[model samples]
Target chain A: MSRFARPHWVEKMSSGMAKPLIGEISAALDTLAATGVAGAIDLSGLPLTATDRAELEVALGSGEVEAKVTAAGTSEIRETGFAGVWWVRHFDAGGRVLAEILEIAFVPQLLGAQGDDIDAAARRLRTELARTPERETGRETVHAD
Target chain B: MQIDETTPNAARSAASGDDRTLGALLAARGVSRRAFLKYSSYLASLLALPASMAPAMAASLAKAQRQSVIWLSFQECTGCTESLTRSLSPTLDDLIFDFISLDYHHTLQAASGHAAEEARMQAMEAHKGKYIVAVDGSVPVKDGGIYSTIAGMSNLDILEETTKDAFAVVAIGSCAAFGGLPLADPNPTGAVPVTELVTDKPVINIPGCPPIPEAMAAVLAHVLTFGILPELDSLGRPKSFYGESVHDRCYRRPFYDRGEFAESFDDEGAKKGWCLYKLGCKGPATSNACATVKWNGGTSFPIEAGHPCLGCSEPGFWDMGGFYRALSVPTGDVARIAAVAAGAGVVAGAAAGALHRATKSAARGKHHTVTVEELEEK
Candidate 1:
């Protein structure tokens, strides 16, 4: 009979650092429970190892929502099934990881566009349209109904 | 020295004799059970109570008798009342106004002078040891509090005498809670907060230049439903509303993390929506629901509007070395502790990262080239 060795994945999952991370997340959830306020855990601020990050990902699996928003760069937001917790990752224009945060909110504010920005964009477009010649733009003119 | 009633509404219904429960009032006003339950759930969410507690809260609030409340205004700008009145129709403020029998308010009550005092005295005598006292503005203790008086009575004396038989006292604004702007440096009136004088009764401080209307309503709802005061922090503020620092939950926090700060109010970084740390946002030291609950029905907060936080909710904020000074420069223990904690977190994180990487090999797997399209697909 041959004895079996522990799997590499199992070895990678068990780490002393994982305990504190779990504790921090638990406390954050407690804050959410006591105050309707959301919390954020900045992964960039944390000393997270590849193995630790991987372990965390495995433990807190994704839920129903997964959103990828593009603005100055790209931001990917994923909600965990547990307690409205979210995993938000922001990337710069160069596609480099800018920030990795664990946010707790009903909706991730990072992925949602700001109302002011949307208003600015619309105003810019209207100004540009007014400046452009209607024939050159190759679009039908809009009229109020 | 009896004062005549100016309006017929001055002779309001006797608060003690009106035995109609809040639920019956709502029913009479054509409010449905479902709507009340929904409002209760919203309040629960705002109060940070569990979803399970909503039905219980609704039931309790429904059966609750209208409690008598005496609202006192002194050494104030009436901004707190203005903020409360700004709430739209059917808002929590309106609901709370409906829930409680506001027996006396110098600003809102039709009664004035001795008539107003008479109404207040009647309510106090009728519901002694049970009525709620909501106070705005600070009590000027200097020269026997002559700086601010109502009906020729000092604010200090009136507050002391009125709250003597009160169940609880709700300090409704930063002025009444922490002496506010009037208590700033070189305070001539010797303004003091309610917590400083009324130590015998439970005093809940809802501190803000003009506190969020919903915050006041939430505290009143908690008291009316549970017949007890909500859990408060060491600062005598409700823990739920004043639990987290504005910096922690700010929308621009990611910009702060990236070390992108707007040096000036009108700079390019400001236009690009960078962090306001360098511009002197007191968010790090201030703890309030402004970031989350927001103002004017969740329109925006000070930080969201591109202005740095004034830390108006915190005590002594008016004297916190100018509102435009960076938080990096410490004014007190709170700012110092926050900076020290940040430094410690970075050190701890780096050390942990180094330890975890120590066990790994220097050589890693071959790099994989991926397109943006592929990432998008994933």
Candidate 2:
């Protein structure tokens, strides 16, 4: 493997320097793992075929966890015990790659000065989630965490 | 004390001829009155003043040829001068002929050699204590000011002599205002800001590579009309213009609040036009009214052009890291730290800001409610 391909070495690289491909990918891990807000990152290594890249985008962007139906037939969102998992990927300046996918679970917080509006809260969260740039930028059903 | 109405004096006539009106001045001479008024108001408003203040802004402008302004040029590309002259809306020509008296600008005026020196001395004598002194570029203080000189006089001596009895001093461009480009990294000339040299009078600093032309105009107007100087900021800049940062008024601020960022330069986020905060925008640290005041008569600003703000208006901006990297704040917790930037220095409790962005969004959702108990079962 080239000096740029090792994950451990990449992680150790200086944050300001021109990052090796793997090092660039590792930076995404740092940006995402620390923040719940998912970001698209780029990795120079592991050039996924166009078909594979599309499939991954669909899988990640698909809000399958949010779409899960509770055991009682209610929405997973209404279920207090529910949590959602998502992967944050890195992208280049032009949306190409250089990093590992950092997966984290999002525990939605109760909204408002008085948590009085549940449905309103749900719709609000839905919009925020919509604006979230998914790998593929679309919706699909998936499993909840 | 009654405000004395004697500023322009002989300085105005000498620098720009005895034409009070811009239309007549431009007509008989060259720059128009309407264009002059337009230029006057355009720059005044950039300071966040009312549009109606333009006429009053103009009347107070000292225009006597007696008002000698010795523009000291130093280690600079003269981009500020070029930028000043290229102002097309009202045009820089109006400023030169109609604004405060321009006595001896090396860039303009056909006088050369001993004649130029004589012209400068003549204007200084004619205006005396009433003239305005403006300095461009940085003054090198090292090696007894040996790095730069004019007529064998060091930039330091020239500055000291001229600023001794000036009505008010204006430090135009970043060079004079702050150390500017010359002060950037390993400065050899021992370049120092104007603040270091002048101790007797209040110095107005108009910082930027060349500074906004309107900023230069408004300062002249403020001094001419008010004569007591406009309100200054911590950096000694006028508060009217440097009061707010571009980030506070950016149109893409909402996107940042929502945590939506442009993924790349040409991706869907870029196509949709998302926030450039993630892309090394120095807007947050910068303090300038560029977003609200805009440029070229409300034409467009840096952010409006679909680029991240380089924060050129802020001091030592060039030394900052790359313009495409996001500033890293302490990630106390994803939710909590996000609130810090969101609350943005508000002490109403960190979570309050998060709650506000949440409540506001929740109120907009408008959906049917479901109980936690029901969700637990069906």
| Interface RMSD per candidate | 19.3, 25.1
Task: List ranges where model 2 is wrong by over 4 Å.
Answer: A1-145, B1-44, B50-68, B90-96, B296-298, B328-378
TM-score of model 1 (CA atoms): 0.65
Per-residue lDDT of model 1, residues A36-142, tens digit only? 76666655434344577767877887798888865334567888867568886655343545346677666665455434345546877999889788655555544
Task: Tell me, by DockQ, which candidate is best.
Answer: 1
Give the DockQ (2 decimals) of all models.
0.02, 0.01
DockQ-based CAPRI category assigned to the predicted complex of candidate 2: incorrect
Error of 2 at A18 (Å): 50
Q: Locate the minimum summed-lDDT window of 10 residues in model 1 chain B.
A: B363-372
Root-mean-square deviation of every model? 19.3, 26.1
lDDT of 1 by residue, B237-260 (tens): 998888877776676765665667
Instruction: List model 2 lDDT by residue over A1-145, tens digit each.
Output: 1102112322343443232423543454455568754332222123233334444444434553332221111111221111243332222122222122222234312111112223445777999888786623444323321
Encode model 2's per-residue lDDT on B46-160: one tens digit a residue.
4555443544554444232223456667667787776666653333323543445566777776666676666667667766777777888889999999898888889899888
Candidate with top lDDT is 1
Instruction: Name the DockQ score for candidate 2.
Output: 0.01
Interface RMSD of 1: 19.3
lDDT score for residue A86 of model 2: 37
